[model samples]
Target: MSGNFKMLAKTLYGFEPILAKELRNLGAGNVEEGVRNVTFDGDTGFLYKANLCLRTALKIMKPISRFRVFSEKELYRQVYDIDWSDLFDHDKTFAIDTTMNSEVFNNSLFVSQRAKDAIVDKFRATTRQRPNVNTHDPDIRINIHLYKNSCTVSLDSSGTSLHQRGYRISTNIAPINEVLAAGLLLTSGWNGTTDFLDPMCGSGTFLIEAAMIACNVPANINRSSYSFMHWNDFDDELYEKIIAASLNKTREFHHKIIGYDKAPSATRKAQENVDNANLSEYITIERKDFFRTEKPVDTKLHMVFNPPYGERLQIDVEDFYAKIGNTLKQNYPGTNAWLITSNLEALKYVGLRPSRKIKAFNGKLESRLVKYEMYEGSKKAKYKTDTQ
Candidate 1:
């Protein structure tokens, strides 16, 4: 907790590499990527920075103890032995969340219950009082990860998921997750170098995320609270310094970020969210159907959007997708268009073979992020039709 300590950042599926890269960029040591999480070494100040700056991370956890427990009694004993009093006060409400993948311990709820009892007993024995349990929202959140026989206990530094960036209060139908939007933009190699557009911008998640990435701004600058502030060792001065330093690193972006949606309600919601993020100067939201309009900018354009899948909205899948292809091929030349959709069958009707296809997930639905490159002139021969 003083000089340096190991921490874990949890992310969505396929975002481990992005999270690891973010950790390394933030000056973390011994960076490692796991399935849906990244592990790194950082000090207490670095921990604060990670919570504030990481865009793709859902939660940041500091592992306090790791042990082998084969039985329920052993689990309780190992958890009780730790000095829970040293971590937080007896009056502070606490909650134990458990996740396990072990043949020995089949129930995660039972494990959480036992750990909670152990902590309560420890407090009662030491201070003659016990901390109350808060299941919904607690001052202190302790994580219990049981893999086979190994258990790793960690303190949750981030109370809510980082995707709740505190900027999006208004959302349209089926808005994309903020973390997922940021990850897909980073994966698409968006560096804020050229004009950007989101043709089907729902709730302006991509628009806001793209502007933040463009300006090198901290992702959660608008968020006011984190679980670290509730810890006994929380340093107010150090956290303020970290926040100021991050704001100082924000560079100016010289590109237009535009968003368009057919629905007036969607456009209004996106504008409100963008205004809440304080990014109205950097982003512009409009009500225009993508298929009915041409490219807004003459220079190079980079687009990433979450289009409506046939499964979510009732529409003619083939006609909608075909119109999408026709609009791009005829009007929006000199552009790179990337869209994510769970409707895999609609790709065949787009009429343009995708230049790049990456497997992704949109919530519980499996999706594909496909890309199409439109050249400046004579774009017909540059792309191949599905029939060809």
Candidate 2:
């Protein structure tokens, strides 16, 4: 809790730049991008703000110590030397999550176990009582990262992943991760300048995220808790002030954010999620087949969605994906459409080349985020040539 301290915001594989930009926009100093994380300088207040505002970030970690390690004994000794009681009480529960990229540490589980043992042993030696491990829902979450034999111990300020924005309780067959949805929207340049649409919106994830972006709402405004709240130095008043200041930054959104789905159940659940997010005013959900309908608005439109990749859902992958392209080419004019899908082979049948193709991951599946530019008369020219 110094005036300014170094912090890291972890994100997805290709989201370092977006997260870095977010940190800088949030007034972070010395913002530098790493593999899947961004290092920056921010005070405790900024830490709370980052956790509240950053949409692309997965976790915000505060480094406590970093040291060189060779074997298990050294790891245990180093971990045991830390003053654990200064952070939290013995009555609280904690958990360690280890990520090892070193040849010395063959197993991440063993490293986590060794670190846990050292922490519990240190507590026992000091207070004759030790905190129990709560792997599922820990009061305090510790992060251990070992790369090329150098180990860094950090406290996970975000107890759960930031993607858990606490707004989505009802989900359809396959819902996109909230963080991924936000990152993709940001990458597609959805800054709320124009109208937004998620044509195949399932449960309205993209629609809600779009509404929040349009309104400049804090990403975690609906969330009520974080790991930092469990720390011994937790400041309730400071957090309240932070939340108040963040709420002050929200602005009114004039444009509409719309969602459409063929299934009635999907539309119903999407409206429920929209209500959960408190964004019903800015968003609208409808039950309609995208391929059978024309553009809802006459002005320029921005679209982002994650269609079924045929991984968990049963469908004709080629036909489904081709219909997406066909519908857009025929009906959606003057629109910038972006879609993410892991079905690479099926993507070939879309009958249009993507203007931009970015590699991304939907959970463990490797996916591509592609953009299609639909001009006012591009489809007419294609049909005219065929008729000739």
Candidate 3:
């Protein structure tokens, strides 16, 4: 616990490499990428900094114990062997979340229940007291991962998901997740060099994320709570120092970050969220139809948006996507347009060859983040010769 130890940062699908890059950039040691997670070595202060600054990570966990187990009895014994009371107080309410891919364990809930019992029994035997289990909200979160016959027990240093940046108080029907929005913005190579836009922005998620990335702001600077704060060995002064250091690293962003939503309610909510994030000085929300409007700036524009996926919002998918292509090709030139949509069929209706397409997921729906580079000159003019 005192020296450098390994930790894992969980992320969304296809974001492992970027998350790893973030960890390495933050001075993490021995960084390695997994399927949907990245493993790195860091001390306690670095652990706090990782939670504070990582943009693509959903959760940061520190593994405490690793062993091999075959039977349920062995699992309980392995869990009981650890001194749980030393890690957290007996009064601190805790919950166990188990994820497994093994033939021995048929149910994850049963595993969690057994592990919880083991922890309780161990505490009762040693301290003559046990902590209560709070499923909805817990002071301490324990994660159990079993792969094949090997098991690793981890402490979830992040209380809730990092996506809850504690900035948004209002949201539309289909608001994008903050972490995903940031990851998408990074994927599009947006660095605050030029103007940024999120046309059809819902609740201004992409707008806020873009602004944060542009200024090098820590991802969870607004968040106040974490599961690590409840640990017995927690150092409040160290955490505060980490926060101050992270805040000191933020740089100035001169470019503008803009969002457009035709719905009045969406624009209002977006403005409220921007104010909540304290980034109103850098972002602007407007209620304007994207198709009817031209580019707001003449400089190179970077665009990333999560358009309507036709899940709940009813509209002509073909026509809406076609208009997007037409508007980008005609109205919005000199822009690197990127959009994510689960509707694979509707992508063809856009009628433009994508410069790049990356696989991604919006919740459970399979999606693609496609990029269309609208050159400076007119796309039609480039092709029109003597045919006119």
Clashing pairs in 1: none
For all predictions, the C-alpha RMSD in Å is 2.9, 3.2, 2.7
TM per candidate comes to 0.97, 0.96, 0.97
In order, what lDDT does every prediction score? 0.93, 0.93, 0.94
Per-residue lDDT tens digits for candidate 1, residues 1-388, read 5899999999989989889999988999999999889999999999999999999999999999999998999999999999988889998888889998986799899999999999999999998999999989899999999999999999999988899999998987788999999999999999999999999997999999999999999999999998899898999999999999999999999989999998999999999999999999999999999998999999999999887797767889999899999999999999999999999999988898888999998889999999999888865655554238
The global Cα lDDT (0 to 1) of model 2 is 0.93
For model 2, the stretches where C-alpha displacement exceeds 4 angstroms are 379-388
- Once superposed on the true structure, which residue ranges of model 3 sit more than 4 Å away at CA? 378-388
- Candidate 1 wrongly placed segments (more than 4 Å): 379-388
Error of 2 at 185 (Å): 0.4
Tens digit per residue, CA lDDT, model 3, 292-360: 999999899999999897998998999999999999988888899999999999999999999999999
Clash count list over all predictions: 0, 0, 0
What tens-digit string does per-residue lDDT give for candidate 2 at 289-387? 998989899889999999888889898988988899999888999899999999999889899889999999999999999999998786679678779
